[model samples]
Target: MKIEQIYTGCLAQGAYYIVSENEAAIIDPLREVKPYLDRLEKDNVTLKYIFETHFHADFVSGHLDLSKKTNAPIVYGPTAQPEFEAIIAEDNQIFEIGNIKIKVLHTPGHTMESTTYLLIDENGVETAIFTGDTLFLGDVGRPDLAQKAGSVTQEDLAGILYESLHNKIMPLDDSITVYPAHGAGSACGKNMQKETVDILGNQKRTNYALNQPDKESFIREVLDGLTAPPKYFGMNVAMNKGGYDSLDTVMDRGLNPISVEDFESFAEETGALILDTRGPADFHKGFIPNAINIGLKGDFAPWVGNLIVDVKHPLLLVADEGTEEEVITRLSRVGFDNVLGYLKGGFEAWKNSTKEIDEIKRISPAEFAEAFNENSKVIDVRKIGEYSAEHIDNAYSRPLDTISDWVSTIDDSEHFFLHCAGGYRSMIAASILNSHGIRNFTEVEGGFNGIKKTEKFPVSDFVCQSKTL
Candidate 1:
C-alpha cells in the first residue's frame, strides 16, 4: 500500500492519495484534477472512491469532476446534503479499496458533514486517519465558521467537536498517523502547526484543543481570537456544495491573449478589474493605472479572495508572460472563474504602447529612517496581532485585510508612509490606495523587517491604542 500527501503551499492545503494493489482512493482534491488523473495513469490503478471530509469554504473541490472522469463514487459522511449525487455513508461504515479498508468516523464540528477516515491496512491494523478540518497539528478547526442563522451556534458546534474528539478520535491507537487538510498559514484554524502530518499520540500531548479539560474550555479557546473569515468563503462553499463550470472551460476563457487596444476597450466596456500578478518589486516600477497588485510570489489566492471578495467579479489579468496559465489556475482554485483574458505582452506591452502608466513612490528603510519626524504619518499594514507585538512608535495600525473599512476615511492631502512585514502587503495597499485616488503615500521598500534592521527608528512594544477609523 502507498499513501501520499499532495500538499499545496499557497493554500496550505493537503489532498491525499492512497493506493493498495490495483485500486486507489482520493481525499480532499483541489479544483484542477489533471495531477490526480496523471498519477492514476502512471500507477495504472482504477480510482474507486473520492472522499470529501466536508464542503470546503477555502477552495473548490474537484470531487464532481474527478468522479465524472474516473467513474468513481464520491463519498461523504451522514447529514451532508450536497446538490450532486454521492454516497452519504453512515458513521463507522467501512469501504474497501483493494486490500485496505477505510472506516468513516462522522466527526462533525468544522462543518455539519465533517468526517475523519480511518485507514485500516490489509492486516486489519488501524494505520492513519485523514482528519480534515476537524483536527490540526497544534489546534483543531475553529467552530465559528459553521454557524447557521438562529440554528446551531458556535458553542453548540464546539460541544459536538469535543464529543467527536474524545469519543471517536481520542480512543484511537496512539501510533496512528494523523493527516489534516490545512497547515499553519491557513485561516481555517488559528494556531495550526507548520507540520502537515503528525502521530495522534504527539498531538494528544501537544495540541491545546485536544487537551482542554472540559467542553466549556474547549469552546472558549476555539472561538477566541478568530478574525472574521474572508468574504469569499461563503461563495466558494456555495460552488463546492452545488457545482461549477469545468476547469477546462474556465482555462479556455481565461487563457485568451488580448491586444493592448482590446484590453483597454474591454476594461472600459465590461468594467472588469485589472489584476497585476507580478512581483511587488517589478510592479512598483510600472503597471497599468488603477490595477491592483497582489503579487503571485506571496499568498496570492488568499489575498485575492480577501480583498476582491467576490468570485464572480470579472477580471482582466496583467501577468508575467509565461505565467498567465498559473495565475488563471490559482484564481480558479478560489472560485474566481470570471477571468476574461490576460494582457497580451504583459505590462511591458502596455508601457510600450504609451498607455497611461502609474508607479508607486517607494523609499528604502534607510531613507525612511533619515526622514523620520514627529509629524510624519506612517501606516502599518500588518495584522493587528503583529502590529500590537511591535511596530513603529507612532504608526497607525491599519491592517491590509481590513483596508476597505477605513481606507475611505483617509485624508488624501495628508501624506503617509506604508509598510507590511515585508513589502508584499504594503505594495498591495499602495495599489488599492492608488485605485481609490489616494496616492499621497510612500511605501517602505522592505517594510517593518527592514525598518528594524536600520536601528534608527524607535520601536514600540506596547500595544497600539489608536482609535479605529
Candidate 2:
C-alpha cells in the first residue's frame, strides 16, 4: 500500500492519497482537482472513495467535483448534514478499498460531524489515523469555530472534544501515525507544531492537549486565547457544505485577460476590488490607484480571505505576467470566485496607458528610527501576540487582522509611520490606509525586523498586553 500526504504550504492544509491494488482513496482534497486526477491516471488506479473529515471552513473541498468526474462515492462520518448525496458512515464502521480497510471513527469535537479515519493495511493492522482538525501535531483543534451550529456553545463543543479525544483517539496504539488536516500557520489551532506528521505515541507525550490529565483542563487550554476567526470562514464553510462551482468553472470565468480600458470600466461598473498580487517592493514602487496589496509571496490566500471578507467580492487582478493563473487558482482556493479578470500586461499596461498611478512612501528602517526619534506617530500592525512578545517601545498595537475596527483611530492630520514584523503586513496596512483616504503615512521598508537590527532603534522588552477584540 502507498500513502502520501499532499501538503499545500499556502494553506497549511494536508490532503491524503492512499492507494492499494489499483484502487485509490482521497481525503480532504483542495478545490482544484486536476492534480488528483493526474495522479489517478498515472497510477492507473480507480478512485473508490472521497473522504471528508468535516465541512471545512478554511477552503472549499473538491469532493463534489471529484465524485462527479470519477464516479467515486463521497463519504463522511456520522452527523454530517451535507446538502448533496453522501454516505454518512456510522461510528466505527469500516469501508474496504482494494486490499485495505478504512475505519471511520466519529470524533466530533472540532465540529459536530468531524471524523478521523483509521487506515488498516492488508495485514489488518491499523497503520495510521488521519486526524482532521480534531488533533494537530502539538495542539488539538479549537472548539469555537462550530459553536453556532445547532446552537451549541464553545464550552460544550470543548467538552465533546475532550470526550472524543479520550474515548476514541487516545485509545489507539502509540505506533500508529497521525496525519492532521492542518499544521502551523493555520488558524485552526493555537501554537501548532511546525511538523506535519507525528507518531501517535510521540504526540500523546508531546502535545499539550493530549497530555492534559482532566477534561476541564483540556477544554480550558484548548479554548484559551483564540482570536476571532476570519470573517470569510463561515462563508467558506457554507460553500463547502452546500457545494460550490467547480474549479474549472471558477477559473474559466476568472482567468480572462482584460485590456486596461475594459479593466477600469469593469471595475467602475461592478465596483470590483483591484487586488495587486505582486512582490511588496514592486507594489510599493507603483500600482493602480486605490489598489490593495496583499503580496503573493507569503500567506496570500489566508490574508486575502481575512482582509477581503466578502466571498463573492468581485476582484480585478493586477498580477505580474505568467502569474495570473496562479493568482486566480489561489483566490478560488479561499472561495473568492467572483474574480472579474486580470489586467492585461499586468500593471505595466495601465502604466503605459498613462492611467493615474499611485505610489506608497517607503522609508528604510534606519530612516524610520531617525524620524521616530523626532516624534512621528508609529503604528505597529502585527498581531496582538507579536505586539505582546516584544516591540518598539512606543509603537501602538493595531493588529492588521482587525484593522477595520480601529483603523479610523489614525489621526487624519498626523503623519504616521507604519510597520509590521516584516514589511509585508505593513504594506497591506498601508494599502488599506490608502483606500480609506488616510495616506499621510510612511511604511518602514523592512518593518520591525530591520528596525530592531539597527542600534539606533529602541526595542522594548516583552510585556503582557491587555488589548482584545
Candidate 2 colliding pairs: none
Against the true structure, candidate 2 reaches a TM-score of 0.97
Candidate 2 wrongly placed segments (more than 4 Å): 462-469
Candidate 2 structure quality by residue, lDDT tens digits, 1-469: 9999999999999999999999999999998899999999999999999999999998888899999999999999999999999999999999999999999999998999999999999999999999999999999988998987567999999999999999999999999999999999998888799999999999989998988889899888888888898889999999988988888888899889999888888899999999999988999989888999999989999999999989999999999999988998998888999998899999988888978989999989888767776475678889887887788776778889988888777676868788998899999999989989988889999888898888776668655433431
Candidate that scores best on lDDT: 1
Count of residue pairs whose backbone atoms collide, per candidate: 0, 0
Q: Judge candidate 2 at residue 305 and give its lDDT.
A: 97
**Residue 120, model 1, lDDT:** 99
> Candidate 1: where are CA atoms >4 Å away?
none
Model 1 scores a C-alpha lDDT of 0.94
Residue 417, candidate 2: Cα error in Å is 0.7
